[model samples]
Target: MSTPPTSSGPQLRSFASTNRFLTEIASPSSLRPGYVLVGDEIFLYDRCRKAVLSTLVPEDFRDFSLHDLDLSETSIFEALDRAQTPSLMAPFQVLFIRNIKNLYGRGSKKEEFAAIEAYFRSPNPQALILFVADHIRIPTDVRRMDYQDKERFDRIRETLGEWCGTVELARVDENDAVRWIADTAESRSVRFDPDAARELADSLGADMMLISSEFEKLLLYVEGKNRVTLGDVETMVLAAKQRSLYELTDAISAKDRPRALALLHGLLNASDGGEDAAIGHLYMLARTFRQMLIILEKNVRDSRAIWQALWQGFRMPPFAAEDLIRQARRYKSRRELTRALRLVARADLELRSSPVNKVLVLERLVLDLCAEPKSSLYEPSMQFAIEM
Candidate 1:
């Protein structure tokens, strides 16, 4: 699922479930037996995680108090058993249960859910269980949530909602994300220029995590200046990400599979989110392909005409115009670009399915894009062209 690379700006939105969790974490007495963090937004998700850790698990008592369990490896029954049993080493117990989909998988799971109901009814007072359902990606606008995620959310609601508090970690809005950057920068005695913040957010697709990490780098880069400008953002953020991105596109267009994969790994390594940023990478790939499609369709020859051909938000950076135009021209026909987009779309669906080893999924995608199509087939309707 598409998620922000990392969390940004310490402050949460008024409507954020994470904010509510922070408030609730303050009064441990009123805490519920368990909470389900339902979303794949890493920034918001990390905030919730930190709140719980700081409140319940002390650094020294971590070994005794903290438990990171996966239902796939360890059964839910075993997890509840550990929760029910008191820890002599620590005063409180905090369990982070991942791979929660295992519970809702095949079989009626009546025995498992009944055990949950029984445990919650007479839950251990000294323990807290947090179910990380990171598989579901909740969008800023819930109406636009993908069909599969909606179904998963509904199923989880029907089952887990009966006993646990639901904390949705949805994507941050663009305006709010920009505000967060400004607020966070000010906290560190730095002035975040409005244009700079907006450009940074736009360039990275409002990914709070990426925005946050890259802003940190920008802060260090402009240590004495104490002010982040749009120029600094383009130099530090866009040059670092977009430049490498275009290079990756160039390699893919040339069918240089090794170079493309290497560039993909470099992009992933440079990112703080690593494999977690796979969706963001795929989003950019789909976007670049879409741009190439438009350039081809309009027969845009020069970099100057690209401005008129591609719309405002979809336009490539100034430095990448010529490179993008050249890359677009490398494609002999529109079908190739459309085929690339279709591959990206398929990879996107696979990522959303919560596959093991996300990096492998990305690597496979790069390999497919670099591979020549077996048949010179073309869709008359050109359905895949606009599918992205």
Candidate 2:
């Protein structure tokens, strides 16, 4: 539902690509038969999707016209077949193909590549193929993108890029993110203070998804004032600092007791209520550990799989997705994660029991969680234990 950032200002690569896509959407004759949206930066992905959906699929014929095909479940041949076959219910077909990685897995998939090339050679004039290669993460500076992701991206470019328009949906830079906050608020008739934008972007690691979500709340919070300030951001976005909790979980997963404890203390110190917020910290910790449990149980190997494994309400923030997956994999089995969850549950109970020193309760919980469990039994005798 988000619009492309204004082009009057300095354009971030992410927004620039989307703006160009929007431009293409305007001129139907100039539009590519297909486009490879090549990054996991979800905010930009959503923008491109909105553009395509609004321009191509009429609201009345959406059910028949829009196809969300995943390569994980649907084969490339079948998807292409669907594209080739005209829809009787609707005049135009808009197919969104996800899990493009499946085509490049294991074997050479020569048949699949050949099928794609054959289709694109004379693509359906009525059908718009939008392939989502979201498995790759492109930073603001793609030169620094991880080596393996680079390899996959290169392969995608060499293969799909040959026929489809390659759209580089890179991550938004911190400066661009701030500019976006201001411009977005201006479009909404709300004045976003400069300091507020900086603080908001910095605190959330310049994550566009998080930035957009929090920006919505700021708009609602300043409904009548027509202005968003740093104080409003600080008030509305306190719980979102759980990115710090992700850091703590990372340390705990690595069994770095000192770092874990340090992060725990850092979290406590940053809290508005300090000891009184121990329960809140425990709540976030418990939620994160439970999420890790689901990732471990489902064998979520990447950000894309994590989205499928975790539901909307239970999902972690965009910034924490990969970190949580990596942390979840650190455990050899489900028992270790469940044990951590049990520890969190016990700490929650202790916090509720009117303890004299609540910090110590959390500290003890962190220490125990960071230690390697001696029991290999899958089912340990622990109450309030959660399973994915």
Score each candidate by Cα lDDT: 0.84, 0.84
* Residue pairs whose backbone atoms clash in candidate 2: none
Query: In TM-score terms, which candidate is top?
Result: 2
Lowest lDDT block of 10, candidate 2:
1-10
Off by over 4 Å in 1: 1-15, 239-388
Q: In every candidate, how many clashes are there?
A: 2, 0
lDDT of 1 by residue, 1-388 (tens): 2332223433546236777787787896669889999998887887788878888889999989999999989999999999999999999999999999988889999999999999999999999999999999888889999999999999999988989999998888888888888877887889989988887877777776776778788988999989998767755785557877899999999999999999898888777577888888888888899999999999999977999999888888765888899999999898788888877877787888999889999898899888887465333343433554
**Quick one: how many clashes does candidate 1 have?**
2
Model 2 residue runs over 4 Å out of place are 1-10, 239-388
Evaluated at residue 130, the lDDT of candidate 1 is 95
Give all TM-scores, in the order shown.
0.64, 0.65
